[model samples]
Target: MPVLILGLVLFLGVHSLRIFADGWRSRQRARLGELRWKGLYALVSLVGFALICWGFGLARQHAVLLYVPPLALRHANALFTLIAFVLVAAAYVPRNHLKAAFGHPMLLGVMVWAFGHLLATGMLHDVLLFGAFLLWAVALFVASRRRDRREGTRYPAGTLRGSALTLVIGVVAWAVFARWLHLWLIGMSPMG
Candidate 1:
């Protein structure tokens, strides 16, 4: 639990810098130069991610139960995750409608993913991990939208073909993850 908390702090704290200290971040980026700054950022992110994975695995072994969620909620999580994958796909796919409307589909997808996992899992470690992500995503989303509005950013209008392709890719990716990757990586099958 301590290790998990530490990992979350390191990971989420670095991620929250833009949301909490935009000026400071900008100043640091300017001082460090873009290449150096990105290299440092990637290194920190990777270390934090490794710690998170290790801590999460340790926490899962203990299996501290909080509340037993109904099976229906678990099933509902599958739907939520499916939507999340689509939103994530929208972030990468060019001219997707979801990105055009949402402006930050990836952040929205993280929020949905965290929320769904929180609903389905009722362990202290699970709550800590997912809840932190949920809060961070919400904050980052709001911050990003506000920044966009301030800058008067405009997204390209999405074509039907692009949107359709994005959806198809998302669905196929979700199917593969839920069926195989989830089980292999997370040791649990979302579909089950």
Candidate 2:
């Protein structure tokens, strides 16, 4: 639990810099140069991610139960996760309507993913992990929208073909993850 908390602090704290200290981040970027800043950021993020995976695995071994979620909620998580995948795809797909409508689709996707997991799992470690992500995503999304509004950011108009492609990619990716990757990597199957 301590290790997990540390990982979350390192990961989410770095992520929150833009939200909390945009001016400072800009100054640092200017001072360090874009390449150096990005390299450092990526390295830190990777280390934090490694810690998160290791801590999560270790914590699971102890399995501290908080509440047992209803089977129905676990099933409902599948739907939420599917939508999350679509939103995530929207963030990457060029000229997707979802991206045009929601400037920060990736953050929204993370929020949905965290919320869905929270509903499905009720262990102490699960709550800590998912709840932190949920909170961070909400804050980041709000801050990002505010920044966009301030900057008068305008998204490109989306094409139907692009939107369709995004949807198809998202669905296929979701299917692959749900069917195989989730089971293989996370040791759990959403379908079951």
Candidate 3:
């Protein structure tokens, strides 16, 4: 639990810099230069992710059940996760309507993904992990949208080709992950 908490703080705290301390983050980025800054950021994020994985595994040894979620909610989580994947794709897919509308679909995707997991799982470690991500994503999304509004940001208009490609990529990626990767990596299958 302590390890998990530490991991979450380090991971989420670094992520939250843009939301809570944009000026400081900008200053540091500028001071370090782009390549060095990105290298450091990736290193920290990787270490934090490794800690999270290790801590979660350790905590699972004594799983504390909060409440067993209904089977329906578990199924619902799959749908939520599918939508999340699409939203994530929107972030990278060029000229997609979703990206135009949301401006930061990746953050929205994380929020939905975390929320869905929260609804499906009810263990202490799961709650701690998913809840923290949900909160962080929500905060970051709000802050990002606010910044966009302040700067009068305008996303590109969507085209049918790009939109369709985005959907296809998202669905295929979701199917691959949900069908195989989830089971192989997490030792659980959302599909069933």
- Per-candidate TM-score against the hidden true structure: 0.97, 0.98, 0.97
The sequence of per-residue lDDT tens digits that candidate 1 reaches over residues 1-192 is 778888888889889999888899899999999999999888888888888888999999997999999999999999899999999999999998999999999999999999999999999999999999999999999999999999999999998988999899999999999999999998987876
- Best lDDT goes to which candidate? 2
Each model's lDDT comes to 0.92, 0.93, 0.92
How does model 2 fare in lDDT? 0.93
Q: Which ranges of candidate 1 are over 4 A from the true structure?
A: none
Predicted candidate 2 versus true structure: per-residue lDDT over 1-192, tens digit per residue: 888888898899899999888899999999999999999998888888888888999999998999999999999999999999999999999999999999989999999999999999999999999999999999999999998999999998888988999899989999999999999999988878
- Candidate 2's clash total is 0
Question: Model 1: how far is 82 from its true place, Å?
Answer: 0.3
Give the range where candidate 2 is weakest over 10 consecutive residues by summed lDDT: 44-53
Off by over 4 Å in 2: none
Better of 2 and 3 by TM-score: 2
On the 0 to 100 scale, the lDDT of residue 176 in model 1 is 96
